[model samples]
Target: MSAATTTEQTLARYYHLHARLYDATRWSFLFGRSDLQARIAALRSPQRILEIGCGTGRNLARLAHCFPAAQLIGLDLSADMLARARTHLRQHRSRVILRQQIYSQPLAPAPGFDLIVLSYCLSMINPGWEQVIRSARQDLMADGLMAVVDFHDTRWPAFRRWMAVNHVRMEGQLLPELQTHFQPLDSAVRRAYGGAWRYLRFIGTPRPIVHR
Candidate 1:
């Protein structure tokens, strides 16, 4: 294989090797994930839901349980991750589509989705998340729900902030180019652990469409 292909293969191997232990080891570091699940459940009318960075498809499986009839699509940059996800989703018996792609690229260009979720994703992508969000906005249907669950600057009590800072220092290196991308939308966060950590959730409502 070519050098680039070889490198990609090596990385995929590394991810697959670690995939089984990923949830147990690294899952707790991603806090406030339950909040995302709760909010998606409350949407009440989501039809087509898209999940970016769907590693191992655990969340997609959870979503299937939450909304039995909705169409689900998951995208990720690593084929190894997608493979694990497929295995987890094999018995769901729902229409779950998995795509191997990075969030830096445009979505499938299929107009839009009823619900779009970014859960602990931006902090691990290439330096184009803003572009990705713009693409998501364009790919959303009118009044669609965009839910984000991610680590934040964690403004809270003194001790919690210190812990958050340290945790970010450890894992944030993987996403060194990521910026605080939550300011534009009307956003709120639930702060805990002396305010050292928070989970941010934002929703945007596009202007209404008028039929000609």
Candidate 2:
């Protein structure tokens, strides 16, 4: 199996086991989610929004509320996660669409979404995170926005190792790549749990694609 496939399988199994507990436990550590959404709302009123790795639909529900007229799509690699998302977002069912798939490439019929979000999801995507970043650029409309909130890195080795076991790589890696593909609109890194770790929030527009 390819590295992406392997990572997907591992994440599927992980979420399958943890889906029930996810919403309950995540709020303690998953900082910047609400802030990220607020920042996105400040920037644009997107007509169509997509959230990659929209586990349990927490942000999807928020997006539905924030942009009531918008069409929302939540894509994930875990059925378990999407199943929870389905329940969590049922009130907005008419506007919300959930899909179970690993996002390795652009969705067909290019220039798809006005806003794409990744909330604490990219860190777990070890080998294929960069590919997903590029794919997000491709999937976006010419003036599309991409917003991300995720673990940045930790100073403690033990904490880093623990996160690694959970399939997250936190080494302050995602920001530079995101900057490379998108023009920065808003970006910041903040400490979590009194310096236990750091998390980043970024909102950017797709940089004009250069074709040779």
Candidate 2 C-alpha lDDT tens digits along 12-103: 99999999999999889999999998888888999999999998998899999999999999999898888989988999999999999888
RMSD of candidate 1 to the truth, in angstroms, is 6.4
TM values, all candidates:
0.72, 0.97
Against the true structure, candidate 1 reaches a TM-score of 0.72
Local error of candidate 2 at 138, Å? 0.8
For model 1 the local lDDT of residue 23 reads: 74
Off by over 4 Å in 1: 1-17, 108-110, 154-186, 207-212
Provide the lDDT at 98 for model 1.
Answer: 91
Candidate 1 on 1-212: residue-level lDDT in tens? 55534544544566777777877786656776666677667655687888987888888888877888889999876777887898889977468989887655557575568778887765433335566676676667766776766665544456444644332222323222222322224456566566656555555444433347
Clashing residue pair totals per candidate (backbone < 3 A)? 6, 0
